[model samples]
Target: MIVGIIGGGQLAQMLAMAGQPLGIRCLFLDPAPDACARTAGELLCGDYGDARLLDELARRATVVTYEFENVPEASLRRLASRVRVHPHPGALALARDRWHEKRLFADLGLSTPPFVAVDTRADLDRALAVTGWPAVLKTRTMGYDGKGQRVLRTPGDVDAAFAALSGTPLILEGFVAFDREVSLVAVRSADGDARFYPLTENVHRNGVLVQSRARPGDPMASRAEGYVGRLLAHLDYVGVLAVEFFQKGDMLLANEMAPRVHNSGHWTLEGAETSQFENHMRAVLGLPLGATHGLAPSGMVNFVGYLPEASAVLAVPGTHLHVYGKAARPGRKLGHATVRAPREGDVLDALARLRMLADAGGAG
Candidate 1:
């Protein structure tokens, strides 16, 4: 089987890695000459919206999947008419814009922080009037890892935010003072079979995911599953879907949803009975969904901005490192390490040991 992937980033690289044992050949469409995923698969170097390139990818792969939501909707729509695209272009379109995403949650009877669309100064003020102070102003499209967003703490910050983020479609969302952030990563096959991973508690630094701990049999697991169920049935979604939530006093408020495999679920590479990347491939191929059971208590710490020494990361007990083979820069995600153990305490200890290795800057 051949799979065509849009956006040749680390996620695509992982997908290609996961597909190899299944006799799945992966190919990628990316404009960047240096896209890291090229090492994993054949690359069709061209603009994302280039029709000639899209036609070539459609002709070559049995199915198409995208690594990120930012792929041009028109391009995908054009390609989908030629070859099958998993998760559907509609789902991709919904995930691309925050306003539509929040509205989908509302339509599905899921809870989300109050939000209002903003397109002008007057719209910003009106949205603020509805959401009040300490609200977040976010671009509706193309924002990730804390980029394209600003928090307005008071009335004083409103004009500046509007000035900075105006001239683009935006969303003003009420801040959720929640207990913690968690995510449920699930895969739904075309046959309607679905499996969900354990809920993961996530910690972020400057809006980038830094750490994630998978807690099996968590109390909030059922609630999170319910929300994801609605999403899967509604989208008739194929492949992995990750929904992030803000937990507050037993309530799970939907924060955002990723249509593809997610960063928080990276621990599943070593911790779960089947890795999410493999399950996603299975789902997209209309194969039976794999078990989502966690094999051990697991934690993943991302290596951002820079990488630690391979020997140091390997020295930590039960720690596995995955380097994306990308150049490091401030706020860039270069790699990650996953630690697993029989007990949660042991996992935490392993995580601590790995963190020390990462912090010490052990030989890069």
Candidate 2:
């Protein structure tokens, strides 16, 4: 089976890696000629709006999915009419806008931070009045990796925050003072068969994921599964869905969700009985879902800006490295390393070793 993927980046690259073992070939449609996923399979370089390219992609592939939600709604709607797209276009559209996404979460009885729309200066004031200071102002569209957002810590920060991100539809989210952040990576099929990976504890720096530790059988795992399951069934969703949460005492507040494979689940690449990438393929292909159990206690460290020496990273016991074939950029995610061990302590030891190497500027 040939699967068509929109956006040719690391996620697509990993998808292709997982699909190849199942005799599934991937073709990517991305505007960037040098997209790293090009090495995974055939690449068709064109803008998302190009009708000719979209027609050709739909014509060639049996199924289609996008690596990211930022793909234009019009493009997805056009393709949905021509080919099968997992998770549905309507789900994609809702996930693309923060306001709609939050409302959906609230409607489903999932806890989310208080939020209000901000379009004009007065709207900002009104939102602040409701959400109060120290809230987060985020653009409704095209924001990722911590970009397109401002943290308003005081009344004095409002005008500056608005000036910095002027003219974009925004959402002001009340600050969440949670103990920690965790996420659930779940997959559902057309048959309504579903399973979830172990909940993962994530640590972020400047809005970018720096590390994630898989907490299999954590007390909060069941709670997260319940919330994510509600979303999957509600969307009649197919393929992998990732939902992030902020935990305070016994409460878990929905942070947001990703419609495709997520950064937090990368540990499953080597730690789970079946990697998230493989299960995503299985779900979309209508095959029976794989086991979601972790092979061991696991931790994953993301390589940002640049990667450490591969040899050094591999030297750590139980560590496996995956480097995305891309040039270095200040905030770009270049690769990640996963460590699995018989015990959480061993996993932490391996993680510390890997972090040391990554922090030493890749020096041996």
Candidate 3:
């Protein structure tokens, strides 16, 4: 089967790698000539909204999927008319807009941090009146890895934040005093077959993912599954969906959702019986889904901005390094390592060492 993927970034690279063993080939549409996924798949090298490129992708591939959520809606509509797109374009619309995502959560009986939509400076002031101080002012769309957002700690900081992010549609969210952040990575087929991987505990430094560990039987897994299941069913989603949550005691406050394979789910590479990438491909292809159970204690550390020598990373016990063939720069996601071991302590030990390596370069 041939799968056409939009946005040939590292996520597309990983998905292509996963599809290789399954006799699945990937065709990518990306504007950058040196898009990192080129090595793993055939890259079309064109703008996302290019009608000719979209037509080429639709003509060649059996199905299509996108890595990033912010793909232009018009492009998806044209492609969907010609070929199938998984997870549905509607899910992407909600994920790209923070306000709609939060409202969906509340409508679905899921908890969310108090938030208000902001279209103007006056709207910001009124939002702050309800959300109060220490709120976050964010552009409603196109924000990722901490970009397009500002944390307003006091009234004095509000004016400057508005000045910085005023040109786009915005959403003002109340600050959440969460205990810890966790994510659920689940897959659902078009036929409604679904599987849930273990909950993942994550750490973010400066809004970029730093590390993630699979918590197979964590007390919160069932609750997270329930919340994500509602979303999967409601959206008629096909393929993988990742929903992040803030755990406050016994509650899980919906943080945000990515309607695609997620960074936090990277541990699944070696941690689960079947990787998220493989399951996503199978789900979209209508193949029977694989088991999502954890095979061992596993964790992953991101190599943001810089990469250490391969020998240094491999020196760590139970570590497997995966580097996207991309030029490194400050705050860029360059690579990652999955730590898997028979014992949870061993996995944790390896992660601590990897964290030190990533931190040394100030990669965050």
Give the number of the best model, judged by lDDT.
3
Summarize candidate 2's per-residue lDDT along 1-364 as a digit string, tens digits: 9999999999999999999989999999999999999988989999988889998888998889989999988888888899998878888888899999999999999998899988999998889889876799999988888899999998889889999987889999999878999999999999998899999999888899888999988999988898999999999999999999999999999989999999999999999999999998888878899999999899999888878988889889899999998998877888999999898999999988877766565421
Expressed as tens digits, the lDDT of each residue in 1-364 for candidate 1 is: 9999998989999999999999998999999888999988998999999999999999999999999999987998899999999979999999999999999999999988899999988888899889977899999998999899999998889888888887889999998788999999999999888789999999887899989999899999998999999999999999999999999887889999999999999999999999999999988887787899999899999988879889988888789999999998778888999998888888899888776666565322
Q: Model 1: how far is 360 from its true place, Å?
A: 3.9
Between which residue pairs do clashes occur in model 1? none
- Model 3, 143-237: lDDT tens digits are 99999999999889988999999999999999987899999999999999879999999999899999999998999988889999999999999
Q: What is the lDDT of residue 259 in candidate 3?
A: 98
Please give the lDDT score at residue 203 for candidate 3.
93
Clash-forming residue pairs, model 3: none
Count clashes in each candidate, considering only residues at least 3 apart in sequence or on different chains: 0, 0, 0
lDDT of every predicted structure (CA atoms): 0.91, 0.90, 0.94
Q: TM-score of predicted model 1?
A: 0.97
Query: Which lDDT value does model 2 have at 310?
Result: 87
Candidate 3, residue 269: CA error in Å?
0.7
Q: Model 3 lDDT vs. the true structure?
A: 0.94
